[model samples]
Target chain A: MLNRIRCLLIKELTQIRRDPRLFGILIMAPIIQLVVMGFATNTDIREIALAIRDNDRSFHSREYIRALAASGYFRVAALPGPVAGDARQLVAGRAGLVLVIPPGFGRQLVRRAPATVQALVDGADSNFGMQGVNYLNQATRLFSARFAREVAVDARLRGLALPAVAAETRVWYNPELTSRYYMVPALMGVLLLVTTMLVSSMALVKEREEGTMEQLIVTPLRPMEIILGKLLPFVVIGFAEVTLALPLMRLIFGVPLRGSVLLLYALSGVFLLTTLGLGLFVSTLVRTQQQAMLIAAFFVMMPFILLSGFIFPVENMPPAFQVVAQFIPLKYYLTIIRGIFLKGVGWHALWRDGLILLAWGVGILSLAALKFHKRLD
Target chain B: MLARAGLAPALPLVTPAPRVWFNPELESARFLVPGLIGMLLMISSVVATALSIVREKERETIEQLMVSPLRSEELVLGKTLPYLLIGLATMALILLLGWQLFGVVVRGSWLLLGLATVLFLFAGLGLGVLISALTRSQQVAFQVAIIASLLPAIILSGLIFPIRNMPLPIQGLSLLVAPRYFIEILRGVILKDTAFVELWPNFAALLALGAAYNLLAAHKMKQGL
Candidate 1:
């Protein structure tokens, strides 16, 4: 049985090696994607174009504008002459944020009266708009505290103390909140899914389409041996992809792998079983390689990436979607990847995710083997 | 402590009152619907055109067509026409669904939007035919079609990720991606109510891309023949 499987494996590898384009796609595509996505995927939105309508033209308003620019979150765009006209910049997408400092003349601040500034935000992209609002709030709070402290110092000479509440915020794990730190680790799951699933699902379908399935079935190898043999080459390819991706992720992208490398590889082994099984299952259901490719792409890969909590947080998803997300294998892998990469947690912290992945691998692979066997018969 | 202190309470000197333009309520559906429409049209057109030529080759019908008096241009057009109608019908259906389900009404010129959709579909279908011409098997065609059309539409087109947030080099690279321009047209027409004066640049870009892809596909089809 081992000898038969070895023969099948060698045949599969030889066929794959003969196709230079397939070899290039299997090896080179992930590296290109990694480099491109490393530069492309960013959520740390900075340099938001801010248009300031300083109606007051007061020293305080100028100082506020200066402070906003100093925060490194905003750059003041060149707006039209009048405030009403400049608001068009938001619609034109020339500015993402607009601050209208009302005509307070600095009198209200000296008299300790409430003043108001209207901030018109281009909310076509709500996530970025909301982040902009949060950053603006923090900068404003900091600016107000500084002003209040100066006022308090002046009042202290006349024997008066001012009330102020200071907020000290500490962000754990990602202190600077660099988005690449989060995105690169999640990208590993996405890249692996694309390459492994594409190659594996197309494997059996290609054989059947090329009219070679009968030749294989006529051989003495059993269904289980054939299935294992077909999957083994892709398993090696998937692992090679991971090994290539991980070091680049660590060295080039600077995403730290804090957990044991052995544990990561072991967990990835279990994860590959699920993905490879999924590809095989897709192959069984379709008559043609085209159908297999379409089903694998639109049905399997799309939902996996979307629900993986790679880009959007699963916590923020609706209740029903959150439930649906629990079924996606990538969801479990993402948690393991993120936890291992960022939190540096070992099997103790991530054992549940590991166990779930193991279950999924077993369930999916068995179903695929059963389906493939029935098809063969 | 500040409220209790005798010193005048330091109230917020400047309050930020935000007004979300184009989408006042900041509805994500409004932004998503148009981009979704672009994505749907892209997948349908690309896949349909990709399979058209490859299916013939798979069934060995290309030999019959090759010996016939049909020109490559006519063959290309014949293959593309049905998918073009399908693309138009799918676009209309999605727009209707978008209005009914998401309250996404087209605010700008429908004429411009229709033109842009047609041009975008042309570019996508041309790329599909191009992929079909290059690959020998249906599997390679399908994989190439998805990889070529879908990934770029999702990533580089600003469907989910804002192009502005990407690094400068990637942002520049996005200009070659067709859906980037189409998505802009959809959002501009549907949400922002942008006029043709503001949208002419996008229109020009789509036309150029459509002509480029179709010309390339036509040239490749001739070579294959």
Candidate 2:
């Protein structure tokens, strides 16, 4: 059985190589996607374009604007003249935020009275809008503290900057919060899924579509041997992609690999079992390559990409969405990949993820192996 | 908490009163519907066309076609035109559904939307043809088609994630993605009521990409035949 499986693997490899176009695409698509996603999957939303409508035209109004700008979270994109507070800037997609200062704004501040400024936010991207608000509040607090000291006498005596309790955020493990560092590692799991699942499924369906699958079934090979033979090439291909992507992600994106390289590769081997199993399972369900591609793209790829915490964190997802995300094998693998790459944690810290992944790999592979075997009989 | 700290006289400096524009309620459906329209059009047209030629190759029907009286251009045109029409029909149905279900009104110029849709579909068909010419299998064609349409549309395009937030190089790379232009046009027309002047560049970009892909597909088909 091992000998037949090895022969089948060789044949599969030769056929894959014969089509240079397909081979090149299979090898390169994942790396290209990883690079693109690495650059694009930035959750750290900085440099929000803000349009300031200064009606008071006072030093204090300018001070508030200056404070907001100084926060490094917002960029002063435009200074529209105060009129009707028309959010054309926000509407035009030029700015995500608009700060409107009323006429009594500076006067209220001089008297140490509470003054209000209207912040017209493009709430279209609601999460981004919320972040902008959070940043706005933080900047206001910092500015209010200084203003309270100079403008309002007896700072602590009168309720001012001191909120009694404050939340100080000290970022640990990838403190720079370089989104690329976090995203690049997670991309390993994502790219692996796309390449392995699609290629293995398509390759299997192609054989069946071309009538070669029946030829294999007639041979001395066992059902398990044929299934293993069909999928093992994708296992090699998956690892090849991860290996290619990792060094590039490290050197170019500067995603430091602090964890053991051997551990990363070992865990990746475990990850492939699940992906390859999924690929095999998808192949068994579809007759045509069209059906296989559709199912793999929609059923397998879509959920993994969206909810696997590849771009959006699983924690941030709605509770219902989070529950759905939990079932994706990639989610656990993603945590392992990121933790190993960024935090340099070993299985001691990541045993839960490793066990989950191992369980997923074995469970999925066995079920798929059995299903493929039954289909032949 | 400020009072509890015993820090009296909490001086409020410029409280922010929030205002929203367009779909002021910030309905995600309004944003998502336009993007979904572009994505559906992309998948249907591009995948339809992408699979058109490759299936023949896989099934060994190309030799029969080559022997027939039909020229390669006619075969390409005949294969792709139905998809274009179907894509438009799908777009209209989705638009009507969006309007009825989500109250996603077309606030911009209809002429521009119609014009943009045709050009976008043309570009998609051209891409599908190009992908068909490139690959030898239905699976490969579908994979290439998805990468071409969906991934870029979701990530590179300002559909879910704002494109402005991407790094500079990726933002530059986004200029090459055809769906980005289409989605930009969709949001411009559906939500912003943006004038043709503002959206002219997006239109121009779509046309250029469409023309480029068509020319490339023509060259590839000639070679393929």
TM-score of every model versus the real structure: 0.90, 0.84
Model 2 clashing residue pairs (backbone)? A158-B7, A158-B8, A158-B9, A159-B7, A159-B8, A159-B9, A159-B10
The model with the greatest TM-score is 1
Q: Per-prediction DockQ scores? A: 0.50, 0.42
Model 2 lDDT on a 0 to 1 scale: 0.79
The runs of at least 3 residues in candidate 1 whose Cα sits more than 4 Å from the true structure, single-residue gaps closed, are A58-60, A81-84, A104-113, A168-178, B1-12, B24-30, B51-63, B67-73, B96-105
Candidate 1 lDDT by residue in tens digits, A1-377: 99999999999889877766767777777777777777677666777888888788778878888888888788875355865677567666668898888787366776766677788888777766887788888888777777777777777777777665678877665532467877887888887877778877887887888799999989999887888999998888888988898889878878888888888899999999889888988988888876877788778887787777977789988899899999999999999988888889999988999999999988888888898889888
Query: Considering every candidate listed, which one attains the maximal DockQ?
Result: 1
